[model samples]
Target: MIVRRCVGLLALPLLLGCCVVHAAPPRGFDVLHYSVALVPDIAAKRVQGQQTVRFKAEQALSTLTLDAGTLEVTSVTQHGRALAFAQAGQQLHITLATPLQRGASAELQIRYHGAPAFGLTFAPEREEVYTLFSTSQWMPSVDAPDERATLDLAVTLPPALLAAGTGRALPTRTLADGRIEHRWRLDTPMPGYVYGFAAGRYQQATQQHGPVQLRYLSVERSPAQLRTVFARTGDMLDFFAERAGLPYRGDYQQALVASTIGQEMAGLSLMSEAYGQDVLDDADQIALMAHEAAHHWWGNRVTCAGWEHFWLNEGMANFMTAAYLQQAQGEAAYQAQVDGWRTRLDALRAKGADHALVYADWDAPTADDRAVVYRKGAYVLHLLRGELGDAVFWRGLRAYTVANDGRSVVTADFQRAMETAAGHSLQPFFDEWVYTAGTAAQ
Candidate 1:
């Protein structure tokens, strides 16, 4: 996820800390898939839903816990039988009808309804958008970055509206009530945060790029402006694929929404509506496009184990955008992008707000914490690339993505890949840039 400006600090009262480490799922189960059925009432600003989760028990467990926000859960059941459940704060705990023994697979279904306070937006005037970390606001799941699961989502809404979500779209069915139900299937496992949907009156255009299909959705009748903004998408897909030594995994869909924040999901990306209008001339928006696209390989495919190593996601995306600019535009354009990040970092240091890239204080990170994590994190990658040289650096990156595809990783994972490719220890480089605070050495 990338934002143009810092919003208010994140305060998640239910979780012990706002960081990923504290919010990790229990080790007893591995979620395999989720089937979510949602009926959203735009005028009422509420959603009613049912979710069935399939998982394999890694250890003997009598109870299961999932992260669900303030939604009102009506019932919990297993195999058509009612099961005892408890909801406290953001956690929903359910006792198994029979203990799930080690290596056994099981399924649980939950029914819930609520007007979500976050993660989902109801805009009867424009479009309904779901932001990152908002998945738990509407659906119950193990809401952590490390836990990945495939999804099947069915959304019921007014017949006039269209629903765009993760993965490929299935045939639309009209219910007897005259509402339309759209189903989407995401067979590739992804972190819970990336599962989302947007429903509203929309105009969609399709473009084919080799085996990957690109779908662009917008509220405007003519999405020519959006098409212009994403004109280079095919070239980017080719560039990142060649650079990372990985082919595009799934079909890509992008939506222009009502917010300024941009997010990259499993096979979908969302950009603020402004990007197609007033922000069209902003070069940063172009870079933002490339950044979000690169996340398919960085953040979506190979995720960060925890927020402490968030740079493994955002930093690589940032650097990869610059690398693409260098090839597509010129070296000057790439240097300008790097310089912009350095300027942001220098300003943070002027205020004595500099922090390490690993960010030890995971509970609460101020605005400066965000800046360092993004800007400084990109700078660290820039330095690493220079030290390792282009040939070795690119090779290591490709190796990293190839080896860790579909898995959660840490900073050490990246460091080890680079060292293996460069045939030398990167300990000193990591120590100064990632482990230590303040600016990179001149």
Candidate 2:
């Protein structure tokens, strides 16, 4: 949810030039040259990676940093020649022996190792490994939601392990000890947090429909549950295609992972193994699946331009999931979810903690703030749709998806698309829901 910023009415010049202009970070790697080797042990919760980032510097720089976390750099090399490198905490500082010129491209290769520490608040003595919340724990780049770039990666894993990530898996060769070298080529640009890696003993089931391929990766012992999980995937794809005006693209697959969380990567979604096998008769679990399915369009396709636009991702998912349930299970089921969300929203607002649906920073919000963002954000879209009517609303959604496909999007962009579709401006509504805090006027 939006963190308030005090701004003067006459500060338009500075706001236009500096504040909004520097919304996202400057990517260190260019389109042409960069490579990574990310190796991980899922059972051990340990990761090691080697990165070779090549970019042209526009001016002489005293320091260059890559977003890293708790990494121990083993070696640094520049163009096959050795170079001195230093690291301070999460920032890897490279002190070039000489100044790099404005027109020169430089290659810096770094080898680093660390087990990600995210949901791990205890000592190693208390627990063997850390359970990480974000994917950035495995490797380093500018680890932010809005930070996006294409990556070429080669991963090595045990022979028995099954690996699924955002990228297309390249051919692998068996190592002498029976381990495998799994190479992946990520042609699409992806957010740092959306990149993923999950490995375990798995059974991969594949189905083909003409040129489109549907795959499900689950652990070795869950064939019975796979029947139900994979059964809904094809139908979900068809539903999204009809609503979003396109089919899911590029190496479509899903992973039934070991953890109790499901995350969407570019082409893959990691579903918790527990959820896969456990009993979930509730609509919430089904809604979660639908929510992740919506991510292919909302989160993966038209990404948030910054953390401030996080509502673009969660709000869309929440709305789409309810829509999916309505289509599949009829209006009653959909209205139930909507009513529940509204009740939650009301409770959050009553606490005097209603936050703007879009947040300006990447930090996790407090529980009350999270409730407001997730619930209120969805309600805002519902209200907008009601105002615009079904035909115009759906048309605006299709236009929005098509116009901003595979790119970062902000609030103004969506508002403009909706305005065009409705044949009138919806600026006041957006301003109340997205720019200001507290309850939107009824």
Candidate 3:
């Protein structure tokens, strides 16, 4: 999800970001998988759904909590037997009939129906899309960035519509009632924010880049237009892989539904329909593509531990995108990108929107804070690279990605990796750039 400051509003205090330090899976359990079956009623702008969550108890417990948002809960069952459940706020607490022992595994099946509080979108006149952090709006699961789980999604929609979701698509099944069920499975565990589905009358185009498959899903643009817009996807993937010293993690990756909101999922990304217009110049489009593609390694593979450390994901992606520009376009282009970010960041601070990078209020991050998080965050990394020099900088980055693969991390985790690679302390650098407000010296 793109972070834009909420203008004309006072920003929340930085202390609020501390309140959600433990906003992950409860200590007693770990989610293993999620199976969601949703049928969207586009005419009514609602969804009827059932979801099953399989989890393992890390400690004995008689109750479990999952993020279920505000969906009306009709019934909940465990092992085919009915169980009592309560919906409180955005959380669903289920009472187990028997106490689950540590290390024991179990499943809870939830039946419910309602329009999503947010996330799922139904636009028959346009397209149905789910943006970031909206996964819990339609289904019940552990919806936190630190909590990762494999997913199996079966979305039933009109037969004329095509759907794209996270992971690889399974064989499509047409129901007798002129509805189609599109199934997708993600074997690799991914954070919930990236879990999503987009369904509409979309045309698809595919390109193969070694073992990585690239699919473009769009309704407003032709296949050729999509090719022109995303022509550098394969090269970006190759560039990131070589630079990070890690192969792409998933079998296939998809870019779906045009929107101005550009977000990175595990193996998928979303582009806005504005891409089809001549509004965004080629350089801007390429930069956007490169930024999201770099996220496959920075944001998707090595996720941030919480919203507080979001820079670990977005900032790294921004830096990597600049790195790509430096290589593909030239040093002049790379320097211009860095200068642009510095200029924007200086403007935000000039307007009295000053916040520390590491401690920025994530609870309600404003667009001004986003400037610091995305642009200022990139500048921090750039400063570090300059301090460490090219040889150690790339080595440190590769080591950081490799060390944190398939895990969530905080800024300190990245600092340790970089320090280890450079064999020197980076505490002063982080303190000046990340922990304190104001721009780093140019």
Q: Give the TM-score of candidate 2.
A: 0.86
Highest-scoring model, lDDT: 1
RMSD for each model, in Å, please?
A: 4.3, 5.0, 3.8
TM-score of 1: 0.92
Task: Give the higher-lDDT candidate: 1 or 2.
Answer: 1
The alpha-carbon lDDT assigned to residue 174 of candidate 3 equals 88
Comparing 2 and 3 on lDDT, the stronger one = 3
Give one digit per residue, the lDDT tens place, for model 1 in 1-442. 7422211123322222122232343568988999999988777888899999999998998888887888889999998999999999777888999998899999999999988877777777874645454588889887667889999999987787766888788999999999889999998889888888877788887898999998887886366766776888888989999988899976888888777468888788887777766446754347777888999999888998776677888888989999999998899989997898888888877778876677545445567877777778888899888998999999999999999999999777888899999999877777767776634434
For model 2, give the 10-residue run with minimal summed lDDT: 5-14
Candidate 2 ranges with C-alpha deviation above 4 Å: 1-22, 25-34, 41-44, 56-62, 96-105, 119-133, 278-284, 438-442
lDDT of 2 at 8: 9
Sort order, TM-score high to low = 1, 3, 2
Candidates' lDDT values, in order?
Answer: 0.80, 0.66, 0.77
